[model samples]
Target: MEAAGCSYQFRIALLGDAGVGKTSLLRCYVTGAQGAAEPDPEPTVGVEFYSRALQLPAGLRVKLQLWDTAGQECFRCITRSFYRNMVGVLLVFDVTNRESFEHIQAWHQEVVSTQGPDKVVFLLVGHKCDLSTRCVSSQEAEELAASLGMGFMETSAKSNCNVDLAFNTVTSAIEQALQQGDI
Candidate 1:
């Protein structure tokens, strides 16, 4: 349900390779508890949704609708269909997995081609950052994000680090676009 006085609505999607912590991040953010009775997560079959109402400091309340998509290649056909109405995207990759990071470009291209390049704001996310052996560095992720004209952030759903900041950064960008008539 929307907050009592919310005036704006935003739809965002999480996209990445399978096992990149998309669902973990979503659960952590929406529930505010990482492991309380958390069940073993099976691979997402297609798409799942979660939403929260956020009241920004500027007094602009936004209901954020989050779409969490299946990352396996077989499910891309289903996930791509949901990309049409997204105003923002979280392009996530596992910091411990270099292959996932390598596929970021293809994922970005799919979303941009489906939603129109300038229509949605993209945020490159390096997930699973709490792991000790990281294959993808922050510098590398930052460089890629910059080259794509997007913002980059690292988050660890397991530890709940930077999760709120990542989501807030995307929402703030969306709100800014809305205020500027860009969305």
Candidate 2:
């Protein structure tokens, strides 16, 4: 929604299994600093909110309301509630963990059932690309994203790889949807 003349805001959510580096990705994208991924990064308890104003390619200033949700089962109820308001979502998965990658479907389904599929734009983010033991191959991730009609990108929150691009990708999709009256 427009906050003032020539300025608009959209709500976006980051979802994935626990320890997928959602927080780290947000930190990297917002702060332009790496190492947000601590050795023992605290698991998100419920939901954390972040905001940043960005100038879109179309030359519009956009405010992004980023909601980082807890991935644990215990917080599912809490996190699910926040999905309805999100116009875009970054469905993240750890590249090093196969289970996290497999859980992408469930997370996407949750958001779809809660928010309605067509109202929200989805981007599949494969995090932890800096790790050498990558369990989820880019081909597999891209296939899954394609099956779900979403775009895919690999990012390393530790090294700040594609952090901005991931956010920008989803935001650009949101902008396109707005133009097409999809949201």
Global CA lDDT of candidate 1, please?
A: 0.92
The 0-to-1 C-alpha lDDT of every candidate, in the order given, reads 0.92, 0.90
Write down the worst ten-residue block by lDDT for model 2.
1-10
Candidate 2 local lDDT, residue 114: 84
Top lDDT: which candidate number? 1
Query: Per-residue alpha-carbon lDDT of model 1 for 16-128, expressed as tens digits?
Result: 99999899899899988764367647888999999999998788999999999999999988999999989999999999999999999999999888878888989999998
Can you write out model 2's per-residue Cα lDDT over 1-183, one digit (the tens) per residue? 343544778999999999999988887787788874456458889999888888888888899999989989999999988987789999999999999999999999998888787999999999999999999999999999999999999999788888999999999999999999998
Could you say which candidate leads in TM-score? 1
Clashes of 2: 0
Superposed by TM-score, candidate 2 places the C-alpha of residue 40 at a distance from the truth, in angstroms, of: 4.3
